[model samples]
Target: MLSFNILYSQERNVYDENIFVNCQNEKLNWKKLELNSTEYKYTLISKNYFASDKDVNYYNGLIILPIDKNEENKNVIEELLKLISIEEDLFEITAIKKCEIQKLYYSSFLTEEQKIEVKNNVIGKLRLGIKN
Candidate 1:
């Protein structure tokens, strides 16, 4: 069971990191902000992007939920999304796009070899979930 858990975690990490790399390629300027919460120590992967009008600055990204021993991924993500939606409504946010990437990278984090490695390792999964 322990080994299976470790394998699952590793796969998830690869998926997450591949998304991060793809975000960098798109010039989204992603950032990981620390949420001020007492219940969970989760990091928010946010990105600053311009709207179609180029007047309003929109923020969107994923909530990096911690691995809980008791809860499944689907449950945890759903609960977190609900909480975020409530907060967004309170704050009048326009939309919520769920995804994760750390730091606003104006430059590439992956080397030439590393890029090839990621492409080979998870070619099918290398996509940023953002639509615009």
Candidate 2:
């Protein structure tokens, strides 16, 4: 498991290099986002554990999740989202999206032709074909 370390120190507020994505068909990768000023790290710990593609269930806002059960990670997640703009070095130029996240997630980390599959997935481009 690669660590992005978006949160670091006791404050849990920092970024580390080589933050890889989870692109396996059986594993999931998650990230941070802010909605209604509430922070959430979109990890496989959400509600989409039993479904896929057309059968997948989105959050209350049509957002998909895998575990969706960590209430305490809210504010910390939001702060992580905010870190994108604060630290340009936090994430790749495309994946972070200037900190405007909407249902943030992606696949595993794989580098091909100098392009990362996970980064492409995060960018919402390239057809990895694996859905949900």
Candidate 3:
């Protein structure tokens, strides 16, 4: 007899059960599906809260680093000084240089002209103060 039998199977939903046992024998189920649904919507909204441009994203932090202190080819100090043009506080500039010199973290975020202008401004300020 060539007879075919159809098998019946049901997909189990996680929310359908309170069979999970806690230490105190308490059973828990996904009773609040609405809360979970709202949570998903909230997540989607929150994701774009910290979104940023792709161009500025690559240099978001000091992810790449030099491992050797004596790596003579690394121009981290030069780059740090160059970028000091954008830094307002001397302490902040010093901190950036400190990280580079001590930890091998490196960054270069400014053009040569910017560095020259900054250096010139500092020199001009000193000269003006000295002349007065």
Candidate 4:
């Protein structure tokens, strides 16, 4: 997921965590939940404290990728950029991309421990920025 900040009326991607992918003029950030030799799983939140809004619920999702892969890998982030598109200045998955990713069962990608951490910690803080 990607967060956005409007600075001097120019939109930019702002993230609390370090960027995991930056390619083709697009940037993305994620939190690592699990890592191993073959692959790792992470969650990317489209919403941040400064960006809390109705879209939060829509754009949150998980991603799993091979550990051997890096930004230098051919079309690594590019393929991801295709899966998670930025719309209206915010990173969001279109219905088509969402369906494609959904088929991969990203939720099942996380282990039980990661699930608890995400629900208890991540979800609790998901919309903390929104005005009451």
Candidate 5:
């Protein structure tokens, strides 16, 4: 089972409790979930499972591929940039980038179930953001 803990710049947090991926004999899972958005901004979380605490583990970095949703075919990266530009602050770009990067350790030391729950919630929030 894989799980995650996600954090947003708006002081919002989410979790993904259990993500199951079956392997040949045993299940392959992750301890933490990390995501890097297409624009090199916006980080998300993920996790993995293991047979025992002593088992060796590997880090799996999942990239969030750009999603095209505009008639001009604007992807997530472009949209994010546009959104950041709307802010009148002189350092809006740096601020947004920092926010995204800061999410890396939003919720560490979470249980497997808690991580999964957070991930699902974050995905829902992302969907809602897209809709709006």
Candidate 6:
């Protein structure tokens, strides 16, 4: 398995970098953005997009990270939704408050071309949102 670290600034800005190599052969560069006074954003910029010939899938999983579940980070979710624009019928957001380390795992079976498309789309949206 691969490992990564998401570093957060005192002001709440978040950035991530890979810590180890794994079989997935994925490279990610994360950027930090402030959504507002109290919210921050973390976005992934991959070295290569997922293949296009495969179908992308989303699964329900638990997030293992450091997050406060007391509604204090509500703006984070709102900012994420604004950035990614999830489909109403296919995506849903829920919060669980039992752990200090939040973990989430989702499987995306996208072809290389499709992965690239998704990366471009997501980065484009994030760029637009941050510029505004």
Q: What TM-score quantifies how close candidate 2 is to the native fold? A: 0.21
Evaluated at residue 80, the lDDT of candidate 3 is 31
Cα lDDT computed for each candidate against the true fold? 0.33, 0.29, 0.19, 0.29, 0.28, 0.28
The best-first sequence of candidates by lDDT reads: 1, 2, 4, 5, 6, 3
How far off is residue 6 in model 4, in Å? 12
**Each candidate's TM vs. the true structure?**
0.32, 0.21, 0.16, 0.25, 0.19, 0.29
**For residues 47-107, what per-residue lDDT tens digits would candidate 4 score against the true structure?**
3234445543222222333333333542443343333233213333222221211112222
The number of the candidate with the highest TM-score is 1
Alpha carbon lDDT at 66, candidate 5: 27
Model 2 residue 100 CA deviation (Å) reads 12
Error of 3 at 15 (Å): 42
Per-residue lDDT, model 2, residue 77, is: 42
Better of 1 and 6 by TM-score: 1
Candidate 5 Cα misplacement greater than 4 A, ranges: 1-74, 84-91, 94-108, 111-114, 120-132
**Which lDDT tens digits does candidate 6 get at residues 1-132?**
222221111112221222111213543333334445644334443222222322332211111112343366545554554343332121332222221222221125333543453342211111110100
Q: What TM-score does structure 6 among the candidates reach?
A: 0.29
Instruction: Please list all clashing residue pairs in model 3, or write none if there are none.
Output: none
Give the Å error, residue 3, model 3: 78
lDDT of 6 at 48: 21
- Mark the regions of model 6 whose C-alpha exceeds 4 Å error after superposition: 1-23, 44-67, 84-102, 105-132
lDDT of 1 by residue, 29-111 (tens): 22222233535333333443324323333333333444332334445444543454444332222222332222222125555
Comparison by TM-score, 5 against 6, better one: 6
Candidate 2 CA-lDDT value: 0.29
lDDT of 3 by residue, 1-132 (tens): 111111111112211111111111321111111221331000000001122343221111111111233346235433433233222111222222222223211113223443332221110000000000
lDDT assessment of candidate 3: 0.19
Give the total clashing residue pairs for model 6. 24
Candidate 4 Cα errors over 4 Å, as ranges: 1-43, 51-74, 86-112, 115-132
